[model samples]
Target: MNTTHLTLDEKRTLDYLESVKTRLSQLQESIHFFLRSINPETTPGTVAWTELHSKFNVLIAKYLHLTNILNDPRIAFNPRNYTVFPFEPPANDQQVQNLSVLLRTKLFPELEQADEERIKEGTIPGLPALPPSPAPNRAVNPAGVNTPVGTADEKKQWNAYKLKVMMHDELCRKADGIFEQQRDMVHTKVRYESDDGDEEDD
Candidate 1:
């Protein structure tokens, strides 16, 4: 077994990665459980069923991204000599379904509850809602033009790429907002004038 010690920063990164791994496993297991309890034939096109698959696809895509980050070689670190190591990422294209048909096998009740709550309260102000995902194998371009008749793979890739871009842009926007808010905060300095008016006391 090849063992190596992690530096303080690397150890923190590893801890977070481990947590993400656990969450991904739990998420997949929950999805499997939900899938096992559903009747796809009976529930086709139903709101609950459609929504369940939609939510699962989104969550799984997010997990795939997290795993990708964890497996990134550029970020790998070792405590010894503070050196980096090259880590080969596992192949996971099969894990992210090229089509949504696979997700129809599940019903995510937790997601259903969350969706209801979100609908009642509404999303955050000033944030754009996610692009409305279309059914699997079907995608519309921003120009309102339909994809060429038989480019399923291209359509899927385009949608996935677009989704990632949107997610990242939203995150960056939130971060920028946080920085701006901090800058906008009114800061008051309490000053005491010493016996000598010439000297300013901080």
Candidate 2:
């Protein structure tokens, strides 16, 4: 922030350092958040599935970038004073290799597979997609009313959330009105039957 008289290269170096430091802190926080939320023994199902996946993805991305910059031969950046994270600050080359394997080979693959399965099953996230209704003349769109599939995040959002809320309220009000009319009719009929029974008994 105080690079008033520094050279252009010095400014770039400082900026890079700041970026790495910020990313490291974020990586630590995201890792801790996701781990704590997903740990079955600690807080099972505490976090939403989408939230957990998103956070973990961010953590992985930041970790990989941080490690790449730190290990770059050109930069030769040392992380001895950097904040420690779940998958960082390895003591030896073997440990670093193992960490990469654990994440890339083991953990990430399984998680991504699970995510795809969930998306197909419409189990979690923003919402599930409804089945396409058969059309008489035209074929079904396949993209149902609320399908949250695809790459763009715009596809995943509840585009009709407000509209749905308004429709729900309107239906409830109409149903309530009809229900009250039926209840009143039933009550009047019961009263008339009771009066007739009394007269017959007399």
Candidate 3:
């Protein structure tokens, strides 16, 4: 018997949800294209599988985030400006898992075939093996030194904060420049109109 209304905040939240959904759709399409390019009739293998797996996880996180936002008390009862039903969570489930297996068994061979074709056509150089990722080293405290156990983490956090501050300052500077440019443009237009009026009066 009771109807709920969306506040401006709720509407904004719904808009964000829609945007996330759109982004997920774009990502899915891109992965589909990648799969097709690797093998016309099958899915992609190891390297592509891992990459797609990571993407799927990201999408699932976004889906969960949006779902949580929708379920929040402030937003849940409200009649959303956008529909939030029929959850389209990112495709990291059984379907993608099966695809990965198929890629390994069938699509990888197809990818190898395509790679051979590319090599024959001189379009691509032979696939070079990738270098291994560097392992992170733990910082050790010197004997008799009174350094805290978390000092390394603290230092990393400080560095991150410093970088964030620098980026923010740079962005603000760019925004100021843009604002000045727009202001100058408006002023120029006003001066031009004044000159035109003076000419007409003369």
Best by TM-score: 2
**Clashing residue pair totals per candidate (backbone < 3 A):** 0, 0, 0
Clashing pairs in 2: none
In candidate 1 the C-alpha lDDT for residue 17 amounts to 50
Rank candidates by lDDT, best first. 2, 3, 1
Instruction: Show model 3 residue runs off by greater than 4 Å.
Output: 1-150
Per-model TM values vs. the true structure: 0.26, 0.31, 0.28
- Candidate with top lDDT is 2
Candidate 2 local lDDT, 7-47, one digit each (tens): 88767777777887677767766776677678874464557
Taking all chains together, the TM-score of candidate 2 against the true structure is 0.31
lDDT of 1 at 72: 62
Higher-scoring candidate on TM-score, 1 or 3:
3
Candidate 1 Cα lDDT to native: 0.44
Which regions of candidate 2 deviate over 4 angstroms?
39-55, 76-202
Model 1, span 1-202: residue lDDT tens? 2226766876766676566657665666566545644645323444476767876776677677766765666765322211111111212556234222222212455654454344235362322233334542222222233443336655564555445434444544554675565455412111222233336342
Model 2 Cα displacement at 163 (Å)? 65
- Candidate 3 clashes: the total is 0
By TM-score, the candidates rank as: 2, 3, 1
